[model samples]
Target: MRPVRGRWLSWLVGIAVALGFAVSALAQDEGYCGDEGVWLQILGSGGSELTDQRSAASYLVWIDDTARLMVDAGSGAALRFDETGADMAGLDAIVFTHLGAATTADLPALLEGSVDAGRKGLLPVFGPSGNDLRPAIGDFVERLIGANGAYSELSSFLTFRNAAGYKLSVREVSATGQRRWSRFSSDVLKLSAIPVHHGGIPALAWRVEIGEYVIVFAGSFSNQRDRVANFAKGADALVVSHAAPEAARGELREYHAIPSQLGRVAARAEARILVLGNRTSRTLGRESQSREAIEQHFTGPLVFANELECWGLPDKEDELP
Candidate 1:
């Protein structure tokens, strides 16, 4: 009995020591990293097709630990955002690449969630203007939240002067040219958008520069390689959709860049990192072949963005004196 009691006591002591060390290590890590850098999180990385493997396209950009910008509130994005434990109150702006259901379907959900989480004031939203086939972003928002439209209750529930206290201000950009427009600019960040070709549908690409880190999102462009290359020049990270493989043809090729094209574009832009997002089963299944094709052109670090994964931005090295 005495020996058994000794062994039990020794085990308890060992467990306590291990727990103490773990706690100390956690504290040290928190102290060292403490919300001082910019980070990118993939809220949903799947394409338009409904699948159990991944959510539709969405992303979050965090600056100094604050979730400041969101791109695309796609299907299941709100749930994924909630899982990140990021304060919705800190979200300042949302940029929708297009008005496709797979890209903007969850906007109402995210707005409602933000209001529920005590977000107050106006939230700016930027999206492409209307073409012959698509409605402009301003009209799209009204259709979603207008007094006589779907989710009309949201207008009252989520207002700047309402009890929850939050409202959305929509801005639409022309979808006619390769001209770059400044969306938002502040001391720490600058955002720019450019019109891109997407099967005659209104679409746009976005570039964000936070400090010395530059990230470009090439949203659904195929034939406009020059526009995309200019928009993504010298990007620290370039995110390309993987919906269309090299074998895609006809109308399908008009909307999305193939794997080889994506790699070539990344190389042309001189990007340091290439992130393949909006992945479908077709693309995911051909990962090895796709990767090899991408490597043929782009020599940078290629990353496959997955849902809820966070990537830290590496600091730019100082130039020689």
Candidate 2:
């Protein structure tokens, strides 16, 4: 192992995750992973860039042992999802941040797996409305499985006639600026969505409250309108996209949050910990510079994420940083 040193250590998680860990060594001997608490595993952490090897953005949320939620399903996500030994039948919902292919390209392939797994319950799918450039999520799913769609045979997922004993309940949340949609509320889980601007891409950010743990997936947004801070307030873990480097401009700045803005968002929301994912080749080797940029406005632990890394809250109250 390399020798531990400097302030950079503080920016990384030292919790000893088999998947990924921050370097801070927050004095946690055993990280909260696998406990009764809520844990988040990144299935795919990279952007849709063809030059990179990392899978597209995907996430798996585990409550105890069963995977309860899947945040996004970008391309190459299915392979990583299956690697975690999680079954689709156990998922409570598969929520999308937007209709972008980087966030939904793996839907057909993932749903195709459900046929073999024989899921027996309602799998709720959530996403945002669309514009002329992008199809609304309902139309998006229908195009994949409707009677005259590409995968017409799989239309059973939209109906109740399949012997598989399961059905998909897909809902498109409002994409109006700063709007809120209380999508689901139950004893086991509670979910809320807020419209966020992704350069007119029609996106929404999501918050999932499982038991007492709160997780926020900011998705891929520029936060130019600043809807994320209030929507993500007081989260245990906030996952944001820092897909571009410090010097990026133009379209890159429009589609994703820059490093400095990422700091302000997490800090303003008072998120206990901030996780950086949805990486790209441009941002991969610039962690040091990004860390410097974020530290200007945020003092909390800043975690740079890797694929399949499971992050959990500290098991004991005192273990939290």
Candidate 3:
């Protein structure tokens, strides 16, 4: 009986040791667990141009492994989001930079995907109110999920607590005339927006703060350099869309920021990291030139984002685990 007890204890100890190693392996491979820090995942990194290699603009902001917010739902973002193995049911809000197809076409896919993933209750959505050329975010949601809208059946199919649950509560930020402004805040996060010139369309740049860390999304801005710099002041990470090259002129200049412009914004904002997103085939191979242009003014870490890449922010030692 003594020998049998000794064998049992040995087996138990071996099992515990193996389990510990397994947990450590998981933490190392994923980096999502055991790390108390903010993370940014690029879902889609391309622009309006459809390529087999890349998707349009979308990003997921995760706080301690739980997805807190989604920024821009561009083409193919849903699939990229799925590949990240994140819980869509945990998403708190969806913020759109602008209503362009490259920036917002995959919203329905995300809505449907979330419902399929057991998302319940209201999904808060925030975006810029439209001008004559575009539809406001509220109007856009109604068009997609209203009584007779395109995906109206979603309301019937996805419900919780015996009621229509998969609903969107839309908040439209109207900074039509304002240069820089803030609108949304909660206990854990604060959201701010500023009007950005994206050709003739109504566009916005967004900044999100979680604890001591700050992330600024310089969404598709052109020529509002000072406003963007002010809005992104001292951000930890600056996400800028590389829409066109520095030499682009005329009407093209009104729509997108060149590489040098993006670098200048990051430098002036005092950002630690610059993520160059919204890449196209034209700008894919010219990374060195872009980096050179950026280095001329900004001396920060530059990352050319791709789909499903996860970036871990610097951990604050004083924060609670």
Candidate 4:
């Protein structure tokens, strides 16, 4: 995502003033995933609404226009992904971290894309089974890919065949901290999933290991740092929410980690690069405090991502201790 600078910052001034400048985008830099390889792109970063500074959480990871897998379809993600010039047909699979409103809001737009592409079979979707409080994976599938699908028969040209729909494969992770890894086979990359703590919510974090490069995407959680630190330890990069700086743990005691907390966690796990997303809707002053706090904790390759900002490791083996 382009940094909300100059013009964009001016627009947010009247709205949240300094919030626009809090997460300054890193300088325009070329990315790497080992010898001209794959990379990860941030489509949206905000938590609830798309803002001048952030969009809801969504990401696209691919290896050169192909081998694509999307994580989360939060508000405006499909539209923003389209804007990134990614090929719809190139999408191999999709995964959701949880079923929260801000997390699963982009299903219709994606299923519609499937119909438009005349896809021959159901696209594979992976997520933990939902609980009483949240929509189960099956219900989520029915709402979007079932016969009475949410966007069923919207247009005459729209053809959502049973074969040309989402074929879900749900996997339940143990409630305890034990991690389960499932692999997604595709021509472009190998996708893996592990359940993480999201406050009694059915949430799953994903790690896509694509040809010598590994990137971890964490969902919103109350204790995500520990879960990811164990599951994604030593990954080349970690894509997570930028809730605040480490010192803001007092404010984030309930559900999210300040950047400093995230930084320390990433450092302990030996993750080389850090990308932050899913910022909350606090005022600009508070957001700035959190951002500054994160800067204090992390002294590695840090990036304040924006909508569609592409990034990756500078070298694959460099991730090794």
lDDT of each: 0.74, 0.79, 0.72, 0.62
The lDDT leader among the candidates is: 2
Q: In model 1, which regions exceed 4 Å deviation? A: 1-34, 157-159, 318-321
Candidate 1 clashes between residue pairs 3 or more apart in a chain or in different chains = none
lDDT of candidate 3 over 154-252, digit per residue (tens): 545323432334666688988487655676676678888888888878888889999898998887888554588878898877898886876677887
lDDT score of residue 11 within candidate 2: 25
lDDT of 4 at 279: 62
Q: Candidate 1 versus the native: TM-score?
A: 0.86
Tens digit of per-residue lDDT, candidate 2, span 87-117: 8988889999988778888888888787778
User: Measured by C-alpha RMSD in angstroms, how accurate is candidate 1?
Assistant: 10.4
Q: Where's the lowest-lDDT run of ten residues in candidate 4?
A: 4-13
Q: The CA-based lDDT of model 1 is what?
A: 0.74
Instruction: Judging by TM-score, tell me the better candidate of 3 and 4.
Output: 3
RMSD of each: 10.4, 5.2, 10.4, 7.0
Highest TM-score: give the candidate number. Answer: 2
Q: lDDT by residue for model 4 over 95-155, one digit each (tens)?
A: 8888776877877776566554544444566766777767676676666645577655532
User: Which ranking of candidates, highest lDDT first?
Assistant: 2, 1, 3, 4
**TM-score for each of the candidates:** 0.86, 0.89, 0.83, 0.77
Give candidate 4's TM-score: 0.77
The residue pairs found clashing in candidate 3 are: none
